[model samples]
Target: MPVERTENRGADELHRYYEVYETIGSGGFAKVKLGRHIATGEKVAIKIMNKKDLGDDLPRVKVEIEAMKNLSHQHVCRLYQVIETSTQIFMVLEYCPGGELFDYIIAKDRLSEEETRVFFRQIVSAMAYVHSQGYAHRDLKPENLLIDEDHNLKLIDFGLCAKPKGGLGYELMTCCGSPAYAAPELIQGKAYIGSEADVWSMGVLLFALLCGYLPFDDDNCMVLYRKIMRGNYDNPRWLSPGSILILNQMMQVDPKRRLSVRQLLDHPWVVKDYNSPVEWHSRQPLGHIDEDSITEMAVNMKRSRESTTALVKEWRYDHTTATYLLLLSKKQRGKPVRLHPEPAVCEDSCSPLDILHFSEDEDAVIVGSLDLSSEYIDDCPWISVTQQGFRGQPDGLTNNKNVVCEIWDGYGFCCVFCSKKDRDQEQTSENKENIVVQEKEVEIFALPLPRTPASSKKNARHNKNVLTTPNQNANAINSKPNAVTPKGKKNLLVIQQMIERLNQTMCFHRSRSLDMAGTGDSGKKKRGGKMFGSLERGLDKVITMLTPSKRRGLRDGPRKIKAQYNVTLTSQTNPDQVLNQILSILPEKNVDFTQKGYTLKCQTCGDFGKVTMAFELEVCMLQRPEVVGVRRQRLKGDAWVYKHLVEDILSTSSI
Candidate 1:
């Protein structure tokens, strides 16, 4: 008889079942590559984890795998199987050919409202499932979000996934998340509810999806933290009322007020004009996904898993699973590649310092000499711009406390606004010459480079005066009429003229209507009482004229006679007057009143950021202003009513 070859292979022989191709991606402890099934020509993503890299954190890796094993959702990345060998562990997952959502968003600059709604809906669905599984995906940035060929989102990267301590009131204290998407509670180093923290990240994602850039961002960590804590950001005017309403609900600074996943599902924007996939609707409703239900399901699953484990242990003659892992590793043999630990930052002597000063000649000051002796400096790839000699600076907005600093190719350049606080801290000429750097306060502002030719020329001139003019005070530099570009000035003038003309036309028409109503007649004013009173009484009279007898009597007349007899004129509150008064009181410096709403820079915050507000202007002018949404305040009274936005309004229409 011919010798029979056995087809059965143990878990250690995973390489026989699948063929690993070239590496596709990599992280600290794992490398992902394309793999093909031996039995079928199906392709899959194989994540190979080095056993040695796990060391003490092996349990966490196992937990992540276990969590993924239990998860089954259309929007979530699917984990097919786990295979272990002597030196490595392999995870077979669904292949997402479209790559990361980060790259997609970057290519598009920003997504339109329709596309954002679709992607965001899928994200929320995945998040709801993850939460219901009693797992918190601590890292939920765009990099963790993937896309398939069909344009559907696939949530991946479960390395930071974890179970909450308890059913309710459970808090996670780990300061483990991306700073850009981290919640305020997490940033403060305080314990935070995992679900609430996840909601906060969703808010950041939503804002970034609609706007091209992040809502809160800065080169300085402390500045970014402060902005996040204060919930300071501008509302993009292009967003619809519904979109703005939803964003406001999700991005609450207070976790308690932030919309939960269930609430988000039920929100108007999420549901409006939205047609859910059949699979999505077939799953349990959001209301069924509560903490208690998840807790019970988790307990049951754990119990079943334990019983299965016991049965397997008994079949293996009471040998623990850990022993099997060692046996499999020994069978495979050979050590995996060892990765170096992350490089440490040197905090000691010869620190890298960047200083900025304004002089008249448009020249930048570079004070620190590179230490060629230090290994750190030798390894540093920073290309010195000073070697190229001095070049003219770009012209742009230059004002007090409005400076921006940016770094390119390891060299730092800034267009900074010197504040009174900074100016007050006077230094000796010798001290200034030495370029002493301070740790606590780095006076850096990263002004964005001008894109247009006109702005480029303007910025170049402005930067010359800002950086090169040593004797010229910031006040003198700020006093130039060209402080704002001629084009910008012209746009503001056009917008203002548009508003003024609209106001004028409305006022003229309103006055004409009032005269027709006899309110403008001095003799009729005494008889008419207050303008509002006449309006109310006229409305009541109009209502009375609509009685059955009056209707029959009016029906018999010609169309013109019936029209004249059916309606009565009355004085009303002019929207033009309301807007005119609000416009009159607003500072001309940085305020722009547009049809959508108004935008103003907060003088009180001082470089914190700009604030944009959008409302139905006609509705606001007609009703009692009162308190509005998202830090909006309105002052209502008999004499004058105006909504007071952030104290200082900058005239720049760039926002």
Candidate 2:
């Protein structure tokens, strides 16, 4: 299906990136067409709207764009890109194949308690996340809730969304929503909190989901308003007790008395079968990039990895970022891969004592044994290094009398040196040193075993039946040629081979670190001093780079604190005088404002006319006649832009 470019210049521009197909939906001002990305071949919903037709409702479109741009959630429909031509604006959105929840409910007539619970939980989760982001979905109905191919709910249509700059308590005067879903305060034309109004709509949505009909319906708008104001609605006999209880609390006529979105989350009906609470504020920062997605984009798009990374991190909703997101979504929909594979285990069941022993003769050094079970050995792989040649001779010995054996069992390292002469001299000797090396994730324990008593030694001699005389033992200890068992010798050879491999690995890392640190020939100078210093610094840098802390910091980048967006100012002037000063200053600063009493609704285009920033400023007289409060609320656009606008207004105004 090809798009007709004759009628729309926007379609002609969109045809360059997307292949527009049949119209999936149509409204009075805009039409949504099913389109496919030319580069990635993934389907998208392209909403085409003409500027002339939108006219007064253009700001609503801008509000929708701004809201969707800042929001990223699993249950929220994503806006990929926005293409604006001279005559039209094209918004590429996530294509939901399962259609609207309204149609689903109509087809089934009414949902069972269990099925309704599932859908309601998803709606609540999405709304909770939206409210936490400081925005409220004023028009939350089944028509705006879409179901995807996997039957998960996705909240859409943020045209009427508002972010109260004065926090949740800030009241909005807009009474524009579906009459059936509108709260009593909205119907009464009274100022109402956005979140509370949304809660009321959710209660109505809940009723429709379980009862297959509106709680308050009338052909006459006046009668409907009366019923809503009276807070009178019939609960179906089939509705559960928990459902009725929550519905009553949410549908309260007074906004202040109504259950809040946060409180509703813990309601019995909402929490039923919802064992795991949704993490509303767990979104990754915009600067966080997926390495796999970037790599795949680079390969498929024939672009450099560095360029693709920069584009994705910018998150400007450009062609490159859109394609990358599509590829990433497709990958996420596929089967999940395990992050860490299980380690392989050795089949041999030889004990540590057996592997440590090098000779079968009675005069061979008896190294301390590790009584580790086969299961324990299988769980923790061990690497043993035995250096037989001694560097220096010890006291009271003709030859070097110490055997140094180092064992690494994944988490810890142990080094032991045992000598027969030392054991005889001190029967109750115990020497142990524990050293923790956090960077290497290893703990070192150097321990020397105690000597056996005379009685135990005599019993060991009786059991072995092979005891050497003192003179013979002295010769055996001094001798260079001692017969080693084949098993022990093979194991000893393997351990020596492992030690060589470990040394090679360490050298490779050291060289790489030095090169990365740019310490070329200077790092190798003065082997005793400068070399060690350079090596230590280089190793520290390498270890820090490889640590999990670096990855964690990258993954959870700097988040935007909500407090910065909520701006308020105190003035000593009268409330009316302060508001008049703001109005007078806004026009000079290229800001437009519509005033009603002491409140001024202001808007401006920013980011080179790419974003439309809308905010509300209210001036209220304090208890002191000479003092007033100036409060600003961000209704739409970027938070930083709103902050700068408020600062600019305050700086230029005399108030």
Error of 1 at 120 (Å): 0.8
lDDT for each residue of candidate 2 in 551-614, tens digit (9 for 90 to 100): 2212121111111112243555455577667778998878777765455777786558743777
RMSD of each: 31.2, 29.9
lDDT of each: 0.47, 0.58
Judged by whole-model lDDT over C-alpha atoms, candidate 2 comes out at 0.58
- Candidate 1: minimum summed lDDT over ten consecutive residues — where? 557-566
Q: Write the per-residue lDDT of candidate 1 for residues 411-452, one digit (tens) a residue.
A: 112112233333224222322321232433333211112111
Model 1, TM vs. native: 0.42
What TM-score would candidate 2 get against the native? Answer: 0.50
Model 2 residue 630 CA deviation (Å) reads: 57
Error of 2 at 436 (Å): 82
Q: Residue 638 of model 2: what lDDT?
A: 40
